[model samples]
Target: MTLPLSGLAFPPSREPSTRVPADLRKQGFGVRIAEQRDLGFMRALYETLRAEEMARVAWPEGARQSFLDSQFTLQHRHFTTQFQHAEFLVLEHRGQAVGRLYLLRESPRWLVIDIGLLPAWQGRGIGGALLRQLQRDAQGSHAQGLALHVRLDNGRAHALYVRLGFREQGGVEGLHQRMHWDVPTAVAQLNTA
Candidate 1:
């Protein structure tokens, strides 16, 4: 598919629902969402996710493949109309897609199915900004909280979400842990940063 990596959903509002805060905004890497034809953008992003040598080595033999074959198949479908009812966002730098936030809504709770920032665009507060946007959307929908599952070995993602106020709720497959960040905590953390 064509890799149209520059379309950004500036939220359902006329302006950004909330700025990333001036201090943090300056730290913004200018990452935005990829458009409908950006499947090719995902090809490279997924490669980077799997290329984390240390994280890969820590996983059990079948861990990577199973996770990819299952969860990632859901993520890899981000560019399709299948996710039209939900929200899938991308973070771009200059003009290249650099990160993504995939969420699913099941009423009263917004499940953050996946979230990631490319290696090159990290450390710029984009992930946090995007997550806060998710937080806003969740609250506006009157959702109770946000949910996500991250493999135990994915220290990077775990740390980011935790700092964003997501706390462990349960574990699965002896690897991934389910997490949630409620509206109050989410807004507080985002504004604090």
Candidate 2:
């Protein structure tokens, strides 16, 4: 079931803040709220991310494109409508849109609705830096922890989350794995670091 953004019952601790960290800004990385103009780039990025999976299918090019379009639309609609309080951010590199990071901060935990980068931007440490910034934000806001779901087949992402102190909390039978990082755990790791 979906709820309008206005229907959200939990008020945010603070307004959405997309301040790009100084270190990231020095590296030409930044983030901003997604806008209507960004929808095209967002759709293209979505397609690029799914290209590998789509390549295995024998469908015609037109059919593949059509399928991706519909899927992106549905996903976009679901996110915007359901997560009323979520922040839909566009990750930028030197002012060019390169990825997205969606988040929702509730009372106890901050949920990473989704985070994705174009294939060209992968393996560049950008994702880790953004996640680290998010961890700090959650801690500052007094959230108990952070939580997210990762595809079971995404070994790279799973490894990153684990390295960042997220532990499996179980999830769908064969699709995604739920993982969490608690504030206490993050604090402990920080003290030792």
Candidate 3:
């Protein structure tokens, strides 16, 4: 069930693909499958993602560094092994890599394993466009919705998900909140609109 790192297989779509919404394309936003050359960037971004949480632990500098290294390694291994078919995408805007998106398609749902953008790229519409595209993809399949896990302390990310129509399903592993964006409800609202 392992998908090649080049593209994703959507159930209803006839072909494997990578896409940038039309509007996003006009704004120079695009995405591509991550390759070996992108490893450093990916690891650095992962570190940046834990910066806030690492700061809150009150651990000494050496201990904090050790903790981040260990945690990052663990998380990386977990994702690669647990979701072998997931697509790892690199987000680019105006020809610069600004973020990453990891998606795993499971039975009855598409799991958004991780999505993170550099600080300068935050609040832009790239993440929203990527999500909307996923919802569109899900609607065409037997999938129920788009699901993701967001840390409870990441208010900005949590709010973004809420704004995008995801509701808290329940608590997941540790401090993560399991949220879902139901496609049928969204499509129904759109039709009504």
Best-first order by TM-score: 2, 3, 1
Off by over 4 Å in 2: 1-15, 185-193
- Cα lDDT computed for each candidate against the true fold: 0.62, 0.80, 0.77
Q: Could you tell me the TM-score of candidate 3?
A: 0.81
- Top model by TM-score, which number? 2
Taking every candidate in turn, the Cα RMSD to the unseen true structure, in Å, is: 7.3, 5.7, 6.3
Cα-based TM-score, every candidate: 0.63, 0.85, 0.81
Clashes of each: 5, 0, 0
Error of 3 at 122 (Å): 0.6
**For residues 1-193, what per-residue lDDT tens digits would candidate 3 score against the true structure?**
2212233222221223547789989988888777666666776787688887777789887777676666656776687777777887888888788899888888667899999998778887778888888888777666778999999889988888899899999657798999999877666455446
Task: Please give, for residues 1-193, the per-residue lDDT of candidate 1 as tens digits.
Answer: 2233344222221222322334444554443444545555665577577776536366675765555444444545542444554455555555556766666676656777667777876776667777777676676666777888888878877898999889989556566888888778565456446
Runs with alpha carbons beyond 4 Å of true place in candidate 1: 1-36, 53-84, 185-193
Residue-by-residue lDDT tens digits, candidate 2, 64-89:
87788778878887887788688888
